[model samples]
Target chain A: MKFVIQRNQLIASVQDVMKAISNRTAIPILTGMKIEVKNHGITLTGSNSDISIESYIPAEEDGIVNVEQIEEGSIVLQAKYFPDIVRKLPEQTVEFEVDENLKVTIRSGKAEFNLNGQDAEEYPHLPKLQTDDSFEMPIDILKSLIKQTVFAVSTMETRPILTGVNVKLNQDKLSFTATDSHRLASREITVKADGINDLNVVIPGKSLNELNKILDDTEETVEISVTNNQILFRTKHLIFLSRILDGNYPETSRLIPEQSKTTIHVNTKELLNTIDRASLLAKEEHNNVVRLTTLENNIVEISSNSPEVGKVTEEITVQSFEGEELKISFSSKYMLDALKAMEVDEVNIDFTGAMRPFIIRPENDDSILQLILPVRTY
Target chain B: MKFVIQRNQLIASVQDVMKAISNRTAIPILTGMKIEVKNHGITLTGSNSDISIESYIPAEEDGIVNVEQIEEGSIVLQAKYFPDIVRKLPEQTVEFEVDENLKVTIRSGKAEFNLNGQDAEEYPHLPKLQTDDSFEMPIDILKSLIKQTVFAVSTMETRPILTGVNVKLNQDKLSFTATDSHRLASREITVKADGINDLNVVIPGKSLNELNKILDDTEETVEISVTNNQILFRTKHLIFLSRILDGNYPETSRLIPEQSKTTIHVNTKELLNTIDRASLLAKEEHNNVVRLTTLENNIVEISSNSPEVGKVTEEITVQSFEGEELKISFSSKYMLDALKAMEVDEVNIDFTGAMRPFIIRPENDDSILQLILPVRTY
Candidate 1:
């Protein structure tokens, strides 16, 4: 096999596939990246036990030749060295040649590398997903949905099913929910579902995180398919597949409070800054609890104290306040994360009571909700 | 004590002094930063066993009122949290007050912090350095000198003296040298040392590393004084003091050869890149050996091999080559470091023989020299 490809384009594709490659994989062949060249384009695949990523570079596009002198063949090169070599290649174009013995030779300008190549047959086959539960959405919307809900997923392995974002679609509205049994984040978006309505899958949060990075924030639409065992996200030239958690995701609808004893509309930026400052001392405590107390005239005071360290208090005048006088304590980290994810200038925080879970929502927008369980700091 | 200061100015000074404060320090007081408020300005000090840094902020500078409501007093606050607090303060101006019980209160906008402050009396006093062996040089020049030589210092404690850069001033030239037995880096700059002649001291590489970070890159002259036990670098608003490592530096004058058997002048960038690409496979070898073989027509070949991984070979054309046919192997890491330190577009590499130490110097310049020992491969 022989081929010459543009170095810059090859580097980008290599990096994308490299995201799914891991050095700690139990299967030795999984540590290598499989390269397959055809008359049309070149495909690079990298995979671990849980996730697989494949990126392609077309031979010719828009009157520009990205690859030439292609001979159809396949081989697997050590992922550890291939990415670095491609990045550091000297010239704009690089040439690759494979001998009958599976020896790989890569040449660019005056540099030449002879690497030991593993047979492509040893790599685990990545079967293409076939299902009718496929849907299309703008790439940016998918990225935002992942960002809003993925952070709240359980990081511990005790509840392995909770380590994924539960994606569900019902009656023209699609929602993503994640919870570690402590705090829960749920986001809903209105999608025009013509034939696909009953789609539910739990994609590993770690997989979504990697997928978010690989997916560009573009207006172009991406196709997503879900099967019983796996979910696939496909773009024009790339495909990302991940194994889904087997257990059923818990029903989280009852965790969010529908009624509030007290509610206040506050400047999101001001409150975020206040919580961040107060958390400096709160971080010493294992729970990182920061107190919020409502005062007269729409003013809310946020404070935290560690006897060994010190105390911090900040007062922010909310835009509006109603219901009853209230005081609540919650993890400052959870609050900060939720506030950042709100992505709005102003938000309404509703508190059912001092001991009950509270929900924060973007003003006039019911599509996104962040619920936090308050600490009993009596 | 009470003072209101511009937040930006305080933040910069706080960062500078914070470099000296380490939480892992054995002395508990060293973990806190001492703030001394006087009628003129405020002084912030942080110290560890190896280095002490003091940064000052004046009450008014160049028609700008940086500090107001100043009441002279002193107190120590935990350095771990103070920097973060100052950085995240809401308003441009921050005010501080201390009660008789040493409880400190910091306020900015509507945010207030009450921190536990230690008595200033318990803080260790830094004695001002008094020495006639003092010289002044541009801060940028000093920064360059440090960067060029400090990386060669030995990290192991086997030879304690090798961990510090040997600084010597003879007549009109100031030189800095560092070596870890296998490789050496030396840089010299012409200074107007009239009153001072024999200023020789060994400053710890770790201390110089910290000092390099605290010192800004500017043409402003910084006053430097050297005592047997300490070296001081003083700028207008900052004073950096580092304890000198106690030992006699090894005689390295014999390490550099006066004559060369063969010398080659090559493009510094091209050679550096070629070596870097070849080192990808070389790194797996404990010695990281990459061979340089001189070929016909001013071409040099660089190659490295790890039998289990693969091999890489790259050839670079030098501008001029006047050398006997030489094939020498050396650590790619050491060679890369030396080449990077050369800081010149063209360099002349002088090799006495394959076994003898070779020196690399900037073309047409004698101020900087890098020498590396070749590993025996045969």
Candidate 2:
């Protein structure tokens, strides 16, 4: 492979593919980044057991040449040094050349690097996932959907299926659900899925997190395709593929409480800050649990005690309260995470009882719901 | 004790003193921050075995009131929670009240934190060092001096004295020298010490690093007092006290070669970048050693080889070169650190031979000097 490429474009594409590269991969060849040169552009691929990423730099786009002197070939270079070498190159353009013996030479300005390249044939080829179910959504919306529900996924591997977020598409409505049993987060968005099959897949939370990092917050559309085992998130010039978890996701619709005995609407930021301060002392406790109590005159008291470290209490007036007076304790960390995910100014919380799970959602919208299982506290 | 203080000021002061507090201290009381209220101001103190810092918040300054409703008393609060609590308080002003039993109540807006406070009497008081061996210098210069030399201090505790930077004052010149026995960094600045006594002291590199972090880069004068066991750096509202390391520092002045067999004057940034790229493959080696070979026409080749990772060579043209041609190998990290600290456009490097120590100094200035011993390589 011989190509002279714009350093900035190469750096950007290398960083994008690097997200999927893992040094701890069991497959030795997977640790190297595969570079394939073509007349159209150059493609870089990096992969681990969970996800694989391919980023492309077009030879010419908008009359600007990103790559030239292209010789159609392929080589795999060590991921460790290739990225750093490209990043620190002295000039705006870098030239890459590979000989038949697999010796790769990278030159820029007066500097030159001779690296022993691995045979590209040894690198596992990511099978082109053949699927008819494909849909498009704005990149920003996809990133938001991932962020809102991914944090609630179970970090513990005790239930391996719970480590992934459940994505279900029923006709035009697309929803994501994540739960670790202690807390749950769900968000829904409407997508034009005309002629698309009813899709149900669970993507690993870790993979989603990496995808989010690589994706820029733009309104550009991203085409998503799902297969029996692999899911692909394809942009204009980049492709992200993640393996689907092999298990049946639990049915979570019935877990939502039918009705609430008490409900309160509060400013999202005020409640978040109060819980954060209260948790300062609660951090040493079992779950960093803090109790919320309804008081007279639409006011609620949030308190936490660590006996050895002292206690904290904060009273915030809610926008509205009704039904019954209640005292409930839940993990402050869970509440904080849930509050942060909701970008709305006001959130209404519905409580079934002290011992049951409660739901928090935007006061005006039901699209985002955060549910927390209250701790049994005296 | 009771006082209402501006949240911003309180937060800044707390952060400053918290630098001295360590949870791993053998003395339990040192883990708590001591707050003492006086008529003129309130003082926050945090101490570990090596250092203690006192940050004072005056009642009023420059017609602005930072603290009000001050009642005289003192108490020690857990450092872990106090800083976080103050940072996340709900209001612009935080009111603090302490009872006789050391129950501390902190109120901000509708939020309140009741924390258990320790007796101030139990907190070990930092001894006020009595010494006439004192002088003043611009804070920015002092900070620069520390940064230029402190990084060279030995991190290993095998020779504990080498872990501290040798600070010396003779007549009017104040110089700081640090070395790990392989590479040495030394910087000097002139201070007004006409009446101050000559002094030599070794200050722990860790403490100096913390002190540098707490100090803002300003031209304001910092009064420094040196005693046998402790050194004091006092600014307008902050006093940083660090314990002086016991033992005499080894003489390092003789290590710098007086005559050079080869000298190369190069752009500091160009050489730094060249060394950085050359070190990419060198990182897998023992000391990240890179070779510099002077060629004809003032061209110098920088290269490194990792048997398994391949090699890199970059030839950079120097501005000027004199004396005999030379080839030397040294740690790229040490060279990078020295170049970054200089902040100069060009540097003159003097080499005695391939095996002896070499010196790098600014082209037209001698205030800062960096010396490195070449590594044995075939």
State the lDDT of candidate 1 residue by residue for B1-378, as single tens digits. 999999999999999899999999788999999999997999999999999999999898789898999999999999989999999999999999999999999999999999999999999999678856688999988989999999999999999999999999998789999999999999998999866888778999999988889888643988898776989999989999999989799999998999988899999999999999999987765478999999999889999988878899999998888858898999989999999988889999999889999999987788999999999998
lDDT of 1: 0.92
Worst 10 residues of 1 chain B by lDDT: B281-290
Q: Rate the local accuracy (lDDT) of all candidates.
A: 0.92, 0.93
Residue B342 miss distance in model 1 (angstroms): 1.4
**What does each candidate score in C-alpha RMSD?**
1.2, 1.2
How many residue pairs clash in model 1?
0
TM-score of chain B of 1: 0.98
For A129-247, candidate 2 gives per-residue lDDT tens digits of 75467889999999999999999999999999999999999888999999998899999999998757599999999999999999996439888888889999999899999999999
Q: Write the per-residue lDDT of candidate 2 for residues B204-233, one digit (tens) a residue.
A: 999999999999964398889987799999
Backbone clash pairs for candidate 2 read none
Report the C-alpha lDDT of model 1 over A24-100, residue by residue, as the tens digit: 98999999999999999999999998899999899998899999999999999999989899999999999999999
